[model samples]
Target: MTTATETLLPGTDIVLEQLPKVSLHDHLDGGLRPQTIIDLAAGIGLELPASTAEELGAWFAEKSNSGSLVEYLKTFDITTAVMQTAEGLRRVAHEFVLDLAADGVIWGEIRWAPEQHQQKGLSLDEAVEAVQAGLDDGVAEARADGRTIRVGQLISAMRHADRGLEIAELAVRHRHAGVVGFDIAGAEAGFPAGRMRDAFDHLAQSFFPATVHAGEADGLDSIRGALLDGRALRLGHGVRLAEDIEISTENGTSYARLGELAEWIKDRRICLETSPSSNLQTGAIAQWGDEMVDHPLDLFYQLGFLVTVNTDNRLMSGTTLSRELALVSDAFGYDLDDVLTLQLNAASAAFLSVDDRETLTDAIIAGFEPFLDAEDAR
Candidate 1:
């Protein structure tokens, strides 16, 4: 597998890892370094399926490719198990930021369920604080190494569980700390965002931001629930929103007709946090096809919907933000301009103040300007 630093844009001298990027939908429990998992599991007296980092990484990748979201989610059992304690969470959180910085991600949101990590006796607040401490350490370390990166926590409530209200409060409580937003994940089919109406209402009243995992495991109704019930600012893995678009070709020309929901999402520029590899693995895009090229990301982008590329789980997908961008570029014949547009979309959709978002946008544009100019001169 190619590391982010080694992956280059197709037919270009530009390295993908050198490009400034933003990640809005990454999962914390899903991004542990394989070696860290082995060490943490050993300290916790837990037995792992694979003894070596390479083998363990392979195990996650193999299991995640099961083509079922439920089955794909099973791999998190091992990862979350090792992260039950404050120490484990801290180490994993620290390493996660460093890895993101290494991959040239300037800003990212790491989402995870605190309720799941309470198995080791850490309170939800304690767990959030531990992760924040580690994030702070990672930021300091990266700065010491001359790399600039910023990250925030997106507290998640398991959709299958009933802690939505509790988790929403937890996120709001930590808003001034490291928590930036709220989310609901796990088993998205039957459990619509409407189930967590009270949580969303609380967040709305508190003026907190949220991003709902929708249009991946379910259809348009799920997306509707996300917008109307969850009041999400962004759609996690909203790739399946393509279903609402009717496509037809006429005399060698193609046209796309948007449904009401699609038109609203498009007109409003609600960010679609699309993960190409993870979407394929979870069979989220199976209805369309099983290949990266078949992903409706291009279609959505062509239609002017706010689309941002992400790696839902770095370890499970054995991918980086850079790798995801490279794959999409290869699939859709995208250039630096497309890459810049995607980063800008993510920057605009981030749960930050308008001023902060503008700063991030300026940084991304500046990073891409040199290469874009070079491309223009070519």
Candidate 2:
């Protein structure tokens, strides 16, 4: 059995690392270990910004904290460079699942662009198959070690490119294999989801789930585009959707007034995948403030915005699922119930079959029961 000693909750005795977690917005290339990068780069003869793994890790953090989305994306250039081969993709995908299991994640949706990995002569289908094989290996390995985990791939199309329709087809074709969803990622500021209307239309016709990257590098309009055009089942880092909300105080009581878009999203229970540390580093919440406490996560949670926590880029943010929950709990003074509610929200929003989702919910409840019982006993 895994003990919670790995992650002691801040200002509490709770061993948070033992709790089950679900990751919805982690990028495959964004979660590679520094050592893996060094090894892969060596194989590809790729020069790195830093030689040692420790310095490379530090380099990723520093570059991501540059506060410019374009600059932040440059870090992926290094990660993606070495991931162009079948072996590279498989190894990274396998390690990604193992790392998620180590962080107490019971389920995760790994998103990556297949078109980006075609540079080494592998077709789109070959890339997906290689990654799926690796994920299967990781799952078997984790289960052998007594950690239960399941993962799904979210095949992503680069928003800057014109392969949306093709990627959508690819994702749908691989639905029975390992792909559970489709997404549009990369350079979100200028490329609205509307540009891929045909792809979104096709996905809707095929009844495929999609989570669009929005409101992270852009504002409310981008979020609007994601919903109206992409028909997204979930929002990828939709933290900036809070910009449409107006907060006021009356008689010493604070209240939030939602705009039409914000009201629709809240009423519809559209999941907003919010990553606190990454949002801070990328200036996604700059208009509100410059700290975790200033993040609109608490506000959205309080307002019933279907908010779910995520580690957008674990390597870049130097974080884990447990760490994200701990940071948010400490910042917002959340209790065990609040934490469990967030996990349940994520479970409900996961891109799995209804039966599979129910099973996952059961597992979550089962896993958290002992901790809750201990808390109540205290």
The number of the candidate with the highest lDDT is: 1
TM for every model, in the order presented, reads 0.98, 0.98
| Model 2 misplaced regions, further than 4 Å | 1-5
Q: What is the per-residue lDDT of model 1 for residues 1-378, given as tens digits with 9 covering 90 to 100?
A: 455368888878888898899999899999999999988888879899998999999999999999999999999999999988899999999999999999999999999999999997999999999999999999999989999899999999999998999999999999999999999999999999999999999999999999999999999999999999999999999988999999999999999999999999999989999999999999999999999999999999998999999999999999999999989999999988999999999999999999999999999999999999999999
The lowest-lDDT stretch of 10 consecutive residues in candidate 2 is 1-10
For model 2, which pairs clash?
A: none
Per-residue lDDT tens digits for candidate 2, residues 1-378, read 335337666666777778898999999999999999999999989999999999999999999998777888989999999899999999999999999998889999999999999898999999999999999999999999999899999999999999999999999999999999999999998899999999999999999999999999999999999999999989999988988899899999998889999999999999999999999998888988998999999999999889999998999998898989989999999988888999999999999989999999999999989888988898
Q: lDDT for each of the candidates?
A: 0.94, 0.93
TM-score for candidate 2: 0.98
Error of 1 at 138 (Å): 0.5
Error of 1 at 372 (Å): 1.4
Residue 200, candidate 2: alpha-carbon lDDT: 96
Query: How many residue pairs of model 2 clash at the backbone?
Result: 0
